[model samples]
Target: MSAAFFSATYGEARQRFLEAATRAGAAVGHHVHPLTGAAGEEIGTDTALLGPADAGKLFIVSSGTHGPEGFSGSACQLALLNDELARRAADRGIALLLIHAVNPFGFSHLKRTNEDNIDLNRNFNDFATPYPDNPVYEQIHDLLVPAAWPPSADNEERLNAAMARLAGQRNPGVSSGQDKHPDGLFYCGTAPAWSNRTIRSILRAHGTTRRHIAWIDVHTGLGPYGHGEKIFGRHSEETTRRAKAWWGSDLIVSTATESVSPRTVGHITGCAPEECPDAAITPTTLEYGTVPNPVVRRALRGEAWLAGHPDAPATLVREIRQAVRDAFYVDADDWKGMILGQFRSQALQTINGLAAEE
Candidate 1:
């Protein structure tokens, strides 16, 4: 059942994934994280590979890029393994790689960002060049991360006004990617984050020789409930056309008016083009909507406050933690079903697309 593929905690989800991969006869590799999980459980990025090491085509489904959002992505990956989708893809001469828990710290701690509070999606930019500046984010940093969990009404009003100004902007300062404020929302790190380097390393290891690579990075906290928004963010006209052809007209170009996400810099999917320069890269983020924008914003603000103030009351800490988790993961049977159905369709689409003639 779909519900069985999902789990309440990251540890349980990891265990289920490892077991499922084993049962599927996959070659597994674990990239252990230096930090421990919220419950003190071991956390790491796990990969299950199916198909020849020299396979020219690669299909990747990655879960847990946004911490608790991993619950849905993990479920999807588990469903794929359990349903023999991996085996099927391998049989078709396409390598199927299930990358579990790309951001294990956030996955285990229920935080959207990683251990360093860096948003992994926004942490993939080149450090040698000048970083992207967000003057608007700088102005609203104080308003976004207040000293208290329940921020003052004055702060809320000011923050809301700031958000209102950014309503239709291509890159909303808050979520776009920032480096000035370490404790602020969506802090793109000053340098390559551990997960950023890890992802690059993984890509170089498995994808350097591949002629074609398709990546489906799963995320949450945007759009309508249970809807998986297919987001493509690359700039190349050629790859963009290929992505459109594969994912269809419903695919949302991040820079387009139809996209629910921001036109942010430093996307994780960008790593593929850099790591595997010769491969034809087709990438999309499957962003599942769990809650409304305001609720998600509130949860992120509260969680950021909690991160800065470690001495807060236990009850308040629990409340903020649960809020952050809930904002990303909807722990209901119906939601799981929606996730499974949509994810399965996309997975099959990717397999068939890669299997098609050039």
Candidate 2:
């Protein structure tokens, strides 16, 4: 059962992913990160390639773009590695590429972003041009990440007020990439981070080889419990419509225009087309919701605040990290079962869609 696949920590999850991929006969490879994990253990992005190496259509399934959320993604990827998935994908002449732990540092440290304190999803923009700016994030930046571990009453009030104001304007969270604030909650890095570079390299290598590509990046911390939300941003409506055709009509598609998730700049899915221009790419995120928005935001703020305050108490640090991790992942058998079932259904749909293209 998938209950056995859910891991308590990053190291265990990575180990299990590798073992399952290898046992299932995937061609395993890895890109080692330069930095070490919190436990002084090494971390890296692992890739498991199934089906023909030179297949014209490739379906890339990724996990851990948000670090702590990788646990569920990793589990799904592992669960999806049985002989049946491999055979079905092969029958469609589709190659399945499982990229596990793209943000290993965050996954290992139980944080949302990478070691650079940059959101991996937001760090994928073109550096040659001017990065996107959000004045709203700047105005409420300080209030978002408080000076203390457990924010003071006044700090809470100010933040709550700002959130309400932002909400009244139809949005509040400042997730659009901000290069000015390095220590902020949703700090988009000033330059390409390691994970950004690594993913691009992957797309160029594998994506360029394929005539058509379908990518599903696993995520959590939004939507109903165990439900997988299909999220898209920074793309045209044509792309969204085509994605619906490829994935399914029932898929919940949310763009920056009307998403509960803030409108953002650089996103990982953009890599397939940008890096491999000749390939027709279909990409979207599988975001599984855990807790409600307020609870998740509080957990994120707590972790973001703790990032600035290293002197915070040990107990508080543990609690905050755990809370944020929990926000993205629900460590229960039923939740795991729900995720695995949906992943399998979506993956089969992608394979069938690719076969139609063939």
In lDDT terms, which candidate is top?
1
- Residue pairs clashing in model 2 are 222-289
State the lDDT of candidate 1 residue by residue for 1-358, as single tens digits: 7788899999999999999999988889899999899988889999999887789999999999889999999999999988866777888889988899999999998899888888888888888887688876777788889877698889989989998987777665457888888898888888888888888888888999999999999888899999999998856898878877778889988877778888788888888989999998899999988899989999999878887888999999889989999999998989888899999999988988898836
Q: Please state the error at residue 213 of candidate 1 in Å.
A: 0.4
Given candidate 2, what's the lDDT at residue 283?
A: 86
- Candidate 1 local Cα displacement, residue 183, angstroms: 0.9
Model 2 lDDT on a 0 to 1 scale: 0.83
Q: What is candidate 2's lDDT per residue for 167-221, written digit by digit as tens?
A: 7342334666678877887787888899999998887777787888989999999
How well does candidate 2 match the true structure in TM-score terms? 0.94
Per-model C-alpha lDDT, please? Answer: 0.88, 0.83
Question: Candidate 2 — which residues are off by over 4 angstroms?
Answer: 168-173, 234-238, 256-258
